[model samples]
Target: MYDEMSQLKNLLELIEEPSDINLDPEEKKAAQVERLFNMLFEEHEEHAKIVADQLNKSVEEIRSLPYSEFRKVANDLGVADSLLFKIPRLNRPRTFMSPKDKISSKLFEGVLPPGTNKAEIAMENKKSTKELSAFVSVDFDMLPNIHSSQEITAYDREVHDAIVSLYVDGENEYITNQMVYRTMTGDPTAKLTDKNRTEIDNSIRKCSMTRISIESSPQEAAVYGMQTMKYEGNLLYTKVVTGVQSGHINEWIYIMEQPILYRYATSKGQLSRTDINLLNTPVNKNAETLMLQGYLLRRIEAMKHPKYNKSYNILYDTIFKHLKIEAATSGALRKKHSKLRDTIKKILDDWIEKGFIVGYKNNSDKGKSKSLSIIIK
Candidate 1:
């Protein structure tokens, strides 16, 4: 197993080249990248399974094994030794740190715009002071700070209190290093501030009407529709619709929607419709109202089951099937029509090229039809 793991890792490394060192370079690159990613994913899953299987053993017995012996066992089972090393790193960081600081820092970093002071922005966001302090302490620990951990703790508390006071007094819009220093010095106006009230007001106004488009990708549309179903509180039924526009070739979209029904029951728990139309909308569309309607029909068909009791569900299922079947038939007709149109266009172009079809005759309809007598062949 160890040998197999090493072989697989070596294979992955060999294929990591940007340019293919094998046949059909472009095709090779595409295949190799896909293969590599899939291989890594499968390897991780296999390693997890091995670790889970080990959980059945007694903890003391497991711990009694030396690192070398454990590595050999894992190797025999095809688990990569590097993966075992990574497990400690992955699990230890959180156990040694407080959740408040680490979790809040991560969340704050994600939400705040670039160039914002992390510690100050974190505090302004009402994050726990002790957590932020611990987080900052860890960060400062990596640096060559002369201050002792005890001194750092005291400084963090003082700064936290001062920042909270200014926040309450409306003197500071957010916490910052400078603000902390000013508060410590007992000077209110000593820090440089960029709490631009105008900017804040403008941001609020701008965000209120902000429209977020999902970029109309098929996967994104499907996920969005599923999310909408989850939002409507129905976890069971999630459906996705995908197809091309009948009349518009090379155009495709998906739609995701939810169907929900609730009724008052005599019992404390409400008697709800057995069939939840949790997903009842088109997940993707090309802005065509008619096409969107067709997409919705497909989703409805996917959700239909006899167990569903809601009258609306039954009606929706019936209508949706009718619409979907009609759209499919119409799509066939449109494809034939488009093919005929293309044929006519090609015939006209060929005639024109051969001098068999000329430009229209004189301005009046009385004039003879455009000449097409010349024979090029």
Candidate 2:
């Protein structure tokens, strides 16, 4: 009798409740719009993803689309123009030109034109390493048109690093080139040779072509055999201005824009001093090496997960997802997940050997059937 009464009471309550959640289609749609509207106003990046979902598009593809598309979508949805304005412009990766400091980027991605060498691109990456603080995209599109030998990459980076240090230190740019090399990017153990001087000169010549050449005086112009240029393009011109004193020279403009500036592929991420130093350290000049180091370090530092700790059991799939997101941010030519995984494993192994990571282990060796894991000091 007690069980029968319990069942009878449950059946009465079941009849009291609504069986169909979407019985009111209008209410169901209203609820979804309400939820989406709340998300759009409350979160920036989330709003982008939500909008992308409503349009039946991937977040990456939607973010990369033209702003005009957003406007058109707004029209279709009967939403206010301010709706698009409120979301963070993920499409901002496109370049912009500032008269004070020039910048531009073409949205199109394609194979390089004939006569374009990819190695020349490696040169831009090396030079921009120090200048780019938050972001650096390694692709053919953003590099300067001027081609350079593979060897000059290190020297190009060094010169730019020194120029930035001088500006930040409140020191005059009139310092000798040799002093800049030794103090900034030179090796103390090895003596600077004639070859080093020639290399430095060559690097400077290549960098100068990125902008309009600047000449301080007629005498200095004659010394270097400066040529008058009239052709104009989107690239910024470098002009030498007199330092208001005899024998003083500053090669770059100093008025509004800071020296060692980069156009895009950089953001003010305000990375830790340790992260920045590791990325800029001269131990490895390869862009891939540095990017990998920096990217992994950032993940290891900032990740908050059930598995994250001094001894985190990071599974391969977890790493795959993280790396895919990171690769998206980098805008690499293609998604090389397998190669990237192998490269990262090798890098971590190397770091463990070098004492950069402590208490490291190979899951394969341990045979810890629980999936791969690593521990760090």
Angstrom error of the Cα, residue 286, model 1: value is: 18
Question: How many residue pairs of model 2 clash at the backbone?
Answer: 4
Lowest summed lDDT across 10 adjacent residues in model 1 is found at 88-97
Q: What's the CA error at residue 273 for candidate 2, in Å?
A: 5.3
What's the CA error at residue 152 for candidate 1, in Å? 30
Candidate 2, 107-214: lDDT as tens digits: 111111222222112112333433221111222232334334422232354454344443333244333345444433222232445655545544454544433211
Candidate 1 achieves a global lDDT of: 0.29
Worst 10 residues of 2 by lDDT: 90-99
- TM-score per prediction, in order, is 0.15, 0.27
* Error at 112, model 2, angstroms: 9.4
Residues 164-260 of candidate 1 have per-residue lDDT tens digits of 3333332333233343334333333443334322222222222211211111123322433532211111101111111112211110011011111
Checking candidate 2 for backbone clashes, the offending pairs are: 212-237, 212-238, 214-239, 214-240
Misplaced by over 4 Å in model 1 are: 14-109, 113-377
